[model samples]
Target: MRGLTAGYGPVRALDGVDVTAERGHITAVLGANGAGKTTLLRTISGLVRPTAGSVHVDGTDLTAAAAEKIARAGVAHVPEGRGVITELTVEENLRLGALLGSARKRTERTAEDVYTMFPALAERRRRDAHTLSGGERQMLVIGRALVSGPDVLLLDEPSLGLAPRIVSQIFGMLRDLVRETELAILLVEQNARSALSIADVGVVLGLGRVVATAPAAELAADDALRHAYLGF
Candidate 1:
């Protein structure tokens, strides 16, 4: 994204934001509640249209593309809500993800891979999503997105309402996924410490724009910045 801008009526949510999520790496976006982190993901996923600038994936301009078009281009967004269909069974939800973009061809095989990645889901494949715990729900949503076979994965506030151990487990899996599968991840998180722990790059947003962009360790080591903006 370069000079990306998006808004809701009179209030601008994303103001001239510039960032990148490289393949085989994790780029974390950290900020306060209203710091435009979620908006950035929405814009890139086509949930919200940009008022200005450009969004490119694998060198293709997706600035004005529709949501489906963006997904077809290999961008999968797991929004803040954990987006599980409560009425659907675990396997059914996983199958839903396979319908999006290019993953449509290998739904069964991908579902098996997702079950392998998330053994808990495999154990409860016949249960409705509403019956799962918070951590299980989070895993289901992420596994759903993974089966889509996207090149870029955008995660929004994935650590919300989860235990520290569960968060660590999920983040650890993300690190392995990036290294083994070479997929790029753009993670928007409020858990600055955990996010930075696995990130290759970290981008800090304040108000509606970026205030800092640096390697993960550098950002984590910045005491002043952490105390002021990251609350760590």
Candidate 2:
């Protein structure tokens, strides 16, 4: 995205934001609460229309595209709050993700890939979604998005409401996935330390604007930056 600007009535959530997610790499967006991190993801996913600028995926201009069109264009967004349907079974939720594309060939390929990556999901396929733990629910939501076969995965707050061990396990799985699938990930996270640890690149946002953009190692090593901006 270039010069992206968005708002909600009088509240300007994003202001002239320029960001990029390189293919086959993890680019993490880090910020405190209400720092426009979620808003940026929503704008890219077409949940919120940008007042200015453009979003391009693999040179395709998606600024004017609808949310579904963007999803079909291989940009899958797992929004904040883990949008899992409590009434659905684990397998049903996975199938719902397959419906995002609806092409028989693509759906079959995505389902096979998702189940392969998330073997635990296959084990609990018959269980009700609500019966799963918080970490399991998160995995289900992520697995659902993966079943869409997106080129870029937009993850919002993956570490929220999970135990430390579970968080590490999920992030470790993500690291392995990036290496194995070569899928780009744009991670929006409040867990700055952990997020930066695993990310290839880091973009820090403050009050609707980017404060810093650097390699993850650089950001982690900068004590002043971590203490002031990341509260670490």
Number of the predicted model whose lDDT against the real structure is largest: 1
Candidate 1, residues 120-217, lDDT tens digits: the string is 88999999999999999999999988888888899999999999999998999999889987688999999999999999999999988999999999
Candidate 2 C-alpha lDDT tens digits along 47-90 = 99999999998898999899988998888899878789989999
What are the clash counts of all predictions, listed in order?
A: 0, 0
Candidate 2 stretches greater than 4 Å from native: 102-109
Q: Give the winner by TM-score.
A: 1
User: Model 2: which residue pairs collide?
Assistant: none
TM-score of 1: 0.96
Of candidate 1, the 10-residue stretch with the lowest lDDT total is 100-109
Name the Cα RMSD for model 1: 1.8
